[model samples]
Target: MPRQTILGIESSANKVGVGIVTDDELIANTRATFHGAPGEGFRPTEVARHHQKILPELIEAALNQAGISESSDVTAIAYTRGPGMGAPLQAGAVAAQTLALSFGVPLVPVNHCVAHVEMGRSVTKSANPVVLYVSGGNTQILTYARNKYYILGETLDIAVGNCFDRLARVLKLPNEPSPGYSVEQEAKSGTKLFPLSYSVKGMDMSFSGILTQITAQGKKLMNGKDTRWSKADLCMSLQETVFAMLVETTERAISVANLNTVLIVGGVGCNKRLQEMMRIMCAERGAELGATDARYCIDNGAMVAHTAALMYQHGVHINPYSGADYTQRYRTDDVNVVWRNDVLT
Candidate 1:
């Protein structure tokens, strides 16, 4: 059989990514991000415009990187169809629709969260693992059973990454590389743990209070009120408090599911501290942990391409011109896993 190749578009947030993947290998992954100044956040309209401006060049670049002709190289077009900022999602969907029509190929619409998990599983080769999906806008424990990715537990309020980024904003941290990464770097010198609310209700967690308290403390620190507790201490404390909740919820899910493997996905999944904590928990339970490369952990077109390729190969598709629409509130469990059989374990 001839190798199958797919072009994927991902513009769910500030990042606009383009990727190409063959059946067995990833060929090219390109991305452009809209970076706001310190203490500033992304606006949907600006992000959408950024995507619109860069997508055409990015698509050409990705195709060029893959060493293929745009006319007849790709088998299908894939895109992050939902679970993202409305404007950004719409921009990517429209672009995907246009590209699919221009290329005369089937369009595969993919759920963003499921694409993350599928990419993790594909890269790590971890079959039927419990997934801890933590990102800027999401935090959930997921596992596959009966042909669906069941949500074991999730954030009841703000997501962990959002909390970190908000705190970073209060501290006037740079958003160049990433606010979370900056927080992590600053946390290395932290020696004291500040008191912050930890809201873990049964299995689900909440970070709203944590974020609020941390932001206040950060303001006070900026005003020279709490000189004893440095910014590093606050960052360290935030990570400790939040990641503990995540680990606890994930462990509970693991115990309940009786699964031996845990896979971490999404932007926050690239955090070294989080990965270490999950690994420690998995080790104690005599289980294994699965994680993708740091690059793949974050939102990218490759993951979307890989996932949509699986669905496209499995006969799942939608009309690019008419039926393809993006959703801002798409749930991970809402996607039907038609590509995989129900796992017995």
Candidate 2:
């Protein structure tokens, strides 16, 4: 069997993930991180500007790292098509579509959230697990139903990961890496001393109030009766409060769905506490939990490439994406998921 190489480009957010994959096997993933020019978090227009400047170079680097000289070497070109900023999404779409045309191969447009879910299946080989996608731009509980990625529930407000990042910036955390990682790192040594809000309604959830409460809690700890509270304590409390909401909501979703397995996807799954907490919940309920390891958990080109190849192999693909537009509002229910079917190819 000839090797099928897929080139994946992910510029949905600050990190541009470029990867080459043969089916679900990863070849090389190169990430180019871009941050706000002068402030914190994302300045969409600024990221768009940065994308234009760095995208070409990053694409070249991905191809170089894959040791492929020409686009013709790739069996297919898969790119994240939507559920992100229009400018950023189009950036990768244009690049990928061009590569596909230059190689005269097929183009596969991947949904960012679905790609995240696919990462778990590629690794854990779980069947029929409830999916929890927590990322900067998305908060969704997905399961395949009636041939589509069914949306069990989602954020009525801000995304969990975005809420964390924004809260981190509010606490003056560094933007070098995401606040989720920072919060997790800080929680390691911090004692959770405050009680924060947790709201998970039905299968849906919200986190903005809790984030604000944590920030205020931190401020009170710094200036209140207990002025000696450690920063670790603050981070720990925040992590706990947030993780609790996630766990509670996911558990509720699992029970409602009547599924015995859970798959934790998206960048926020990088949190050890989240994994552990979810593990405990699944254990107590006698349900299996499928959470991708750090490498496969975070948003990377590998997931995008892996998902795109799967989409192509499943025959769920689009074409003429050279002028392919970006989708600022890509939802999980945008397309039906055709799992493990030969007709997909």
Candidate 3:
């Protein structure tokens, strides 16, 4: 088959992204993030409005970056269909449908989680590996089986990224770029690891308890109480505790899957500390660790484009203008892996 370009749209969170990917390579990627008020989280409607307002400019920028004409150069239009904020997903869906109709191309629906895993594999070239997917809204350890990726373990409560973001807001950290990034920097200077709750239920973990403990500490710090912990210490401790839990769960999952390679994906995967921890764990077990830089780790359009292209090539696609819907709770195990070889695929 001849190589073709795929254009993808991603508006799963505060960031709105667009990118172009060919059958073999990513050509362009562009994104614009919406900043929320300090100590506040983004509202769904507000995020959707942000995406709607900037999507056009982002698409144009991505096209220009790819050095291509409009939809004419794009062989398929792919958009994140579910497992995200409704309004934001709708924004991407609408834009994608419009592009598909305009260009007379097929509209491919891409699962957000599946896209992350697929992107990780594409970049790292890990043919088959246990995947640790972590982000602001999700955390799960997955591996491919029968016809889908099965979740071996996941967060029982809040996601690790959400925990970090909330803690950052409580500490009055700047939200520029990302709160997690700011926390990572402050943690570098931290010298102590404070005591906090660590909850692990079998293969699953709970972050709510840890978050509650940290929140109380943050309040005490704000009130000028002599809690014997600095904000940096708290940040560092939070990261260490949460990342340790993640690494442990991933280690177990790797053992269960008996896989020699591990791939970390999603927004929180950009954390260097997490990568380092994973490296150590992989080394201890004599396994390979596969991870990408911020470009592929964070939520972006390129991953969607790449995944959708693979699906399209394998004759796995959805009809254009048939149904344009998004969901807030799409699970990774629900999607069928039609692009990759499986007994069902």
Q: How many backbone clashes does candidate 1 have?
A: 0
* TM-score attained by model 1: 0.98
After TM-score superposition, the amount by which residue 138's alpha carbon in candidate 1 deviates from its true location, in angstroms, is: 0.4
The local distance difference test score of model 2 is 0.77
- The residue-by-residue lDDT of candidate 2 on 1-345, one tens digit each, is 566888888878777778788854677887767765222677666776777778778778878887889666888878887788877777788778777777888878888888888878778888778898887778888777666778888888888888667656655666666667776787789754677777878878887787777667666654664555566777777778767877888888887777889998888887888899999999999999888766777777888898888777767666654455668777788766776432211
Model 2 residue 149 distance off true place after TM-score fit, in angstroms: 1.8
Model 3, residue 315: distance off in Å is 1.9
Candidate 1 vs 2: which has more TM-score? 1
Q: TM-scores for all candidates?
A: 0.98, 0.89, 0.96
Q: Which candidate, 1 or 2, has the higher lDDT?
A: 1
Residue 46, candidate 1: C-alpha displacement in angstroms: 0.9
Tell me the whole-model lDDT of each prediction, alpha carbons only. 0.90, 0.77, 0.89
TM-score of structure candidate 3: 0.96
What total of clashing residue pairs does each candidate reach?
0, 7, 0
Best by TM-score: 1
In candidate 2, which residue ranges exceed 4 Å CA deviation? 1-3, 37-39, 218-230, 340-345
Deviating ranges (above 4 Å) for candidate 1? none
Mind giving the per-residue lDDT tens digits that candidate 1 earns over 115-229?
A: 9999999888898898999999999999887778999999988788898889889898889778888888888889999999879898899899898898999999999987778
